[model samples]
Target chain A: MLRQLISANMNSLLRHFLILTAMLVSSGLFAQSGGEDFMRSMGKMYVVVAVIVAIFIGIVLFLIFLDKRLTKLENQIKENGKAR
Target chain B: MVKHWWKILGVALLIFAFTAGLLTPIRPGINDIQPTAVVAGQTVSLTLTGYNTDFNQEQAPKVILWKDGDHIINALGVSVLNSRQVQATFQLPTAFPLDEINELKVSTSDPANGFITALPRLRISGMEKGGEAAASAWTGTIENTDSKGGFTFPYLPNIYESVRNTFYHVALWFAMFTLFTLGVIASIRYLLTRNVMFEQRAVSYTSVGILFGILGLITGAIWAQYTWNKAWSWDIKQTMTAIVLLIYGAYFVLRISFEDSDQKARISAVYNIFAFASIIPLLYVIPRITESLHPGGQGNPAFSRGDLDNNVRMIFYPAIIGWILLGLWMAQLNFRMMKIKERLLENEY
Candidate 1:
């Protein structure tokens, strides 16, 4: 029963992907008709900026987490020295 | 020493690429204006102006007037009239009824290649009100068009050039955000471990972040003036940016407010986290919902792939990379300098 349910869900996901692909192709053709290419270019530019920001933020978050861990270890070392 | 050498090389390469990118004779595509409407059976004249690069004369522009993509009038071999001016005149079709649609394109072929540069514009405006009738009839070669079409793509270069300032302004904010995030993390660690080094790092990052935040605000203010007709408008984006600066500004005040070092660090760290929380709503959330004249304002067209053309992308992408790398270099120096300063203070006392 579980296997059957998983198969059904995968089928639905695949169908959705195909529909999205179709929509994208149709819109691209529509944009080409006007020859303006403004909207399409704007989307790409937005994604580029978004990606840059996301990566920068992700790296910073990771470094912050690392700093926290390192500080914890250093404190443990100090406590050990006091006990010794 | 090796790391220092690599850093120096990185800075030098960034400078070289940036300079080369700026100096390259790329066409900053100008803006073209379209006429909103026109009346039938009335005579109208169309006027157009050309904006060229550093070497305008080299490109002999050919202005073509079209009705629904069909060529109506063509002017070619246009030369520089006096210094930087290229004049052309065209008469609107009297036969087309009111609300007739038409387009005007100004093109210049590359002297190097046969490929033409066509900056297509719309010309759908109506005839002017009671004018000197005689002034309308004369459609001669080498004459200017009287029909008041809106400013062409020529006005766009100034706007596009302003985007370069984004590198400096946005870079400062990016660096500031990075540093402040570090400060907040260190503060949190200090709470858990009660380590002084963690506290020191937190203080250093906050200080550096504030410095960058101030620089970002200054550059953004100057840029806003030329682009928006005012240095500081009460626009949501501008206002929010100012608020972010203020929040960080208060971080300093909160630090100095308390004399005890431990108390200052603890309070300031809490404030740093709070300031960062506000950053999300102010810079990201608020700007999207509020009305703004800035590009990508609420309900306004945001910058995306569709908006940035090859002409824009040629300069914009390299600019982002160059600016980010430069920011990293500066942050590294700031972080190192901060360490030395703290060490000096420790020894002196």
Candidate 2:
């Protein structure tokens, strides 16, 4: 049963990869965009956008980690106090 | 308190770095050319694409082609396609020496947009030894670019705007080194005093250091994909850093394998010190001796012949301070939470 589930996940992953590959080929992405093209688009603000987005996601992840810890700490304190 | 002041400083510095890093524009640069190599004396059409260039502004966007260090020629029939793309037809003098120029220096200048100075080696091939440059070949003079600059990062051709990754990629390593150093120091203090609190701080700082190191690797891979045209080049520096991370990773794994808390703390602390000691040679010395694509390694200019000028240094230095302080703040928070969990577990027993 576990092996079947694992195979299903692999099959779905491969399907998504194939679809993305097909889209990339059809769109002429390789022919069109060089390395600098993405950064240069929209008056060169996209590099800034990429950077700000990366930092934003990093900070958000840290916040989530903090939040999870705080919640766990609060729960532990409450349960102990109630037992007392 | 005194501690609170530094935390405020960290936040303030980051805000400054963000504004300065993002707001500052890259100076003009030519990124690449199609038909990079050309047959001499043949009429070759070349497309030149660049960043922050204003070819449209020029009346006749001209290109100077240089053979030797001193010799220069004007490419024939230059036309501006757009702001970024310029096409030039070069009618090469049939007898120009192939050995004389492996690459022809291609320079385009606009009065308003400034110059991409020091462009050389655009790859001219297949020409015999020539007489002096024909009078027609010397169509225009190679003049210097005018600077209309306030503050800007030096425009690196291949790097382009991604030069801004200096803040995230390079500074993350700086922060990781700072945090890891603090971790090793705390671990040493724990060894001397047998204080569990010192051990806690050591573990907390190392954990946060690991997080930043991972983030550095990710940012590097992203930058490399755009700049070096690969996600992972397996460059010497990359391999060494991965190995360093793996050694520290083993420290964490070893901690989990210990049943006794004291054993976990002491042994991991020792391993942490060993990890720190090995990393200096791994990150610093070894990569210097070997070839590496990394900016500072193997005597490649500390990011291209010191192209990092005052404009970038202003934001870059502060960004390092902010990230290190921010990493420390996270470590402190984690340490306190660990204490909370520790006390609660004691109550359960």
* TM-score on alpha carbons, each prediction: 0.59, 0.77
lDDT by residue for model 2 (B144-185), tens: 556547788877656666677788777878999999999999
Model 1, A1-84: lDDT tens digits are: 456446535643543354334333333444455542332243222222222333344334334534543465456556656766
TM-score of 1: 0.59
Superposed on the true chain A, the predicted chain A of model 1 yields a TM-score of 0.48
* Highest lDDT against the true fold, candidate: 2
> Fraction of true inter-chain Cα contacts (below 8 Å) kept per model?
0.00, 0.13
Per-residue C-alpha lDDT of model 2 across residues A1-84, encoded as one tens digit per residue: 457446545644553354334333322343256555655554444544554455555555556666766787798788778877
Q: lDDT tens string, model 1, B1-349?
A: 7857646665665565455434433333323322324343443333333333322455654454443333334542345453224444444544432233443444433332222233545445543333344333323232233322222111234354334333445545666777777778888888778776777677667755665565555445445544564657887877887788788777766765676778876777777788878988888788888778776776432343344545445544555455445545545554554555455445421
Model 2 whole-model lDDT (C-alpha atoms): 0.73
lDDT of 2 at B298: 69
How accurately is candidate 2 docked according to DockQ?
0.13
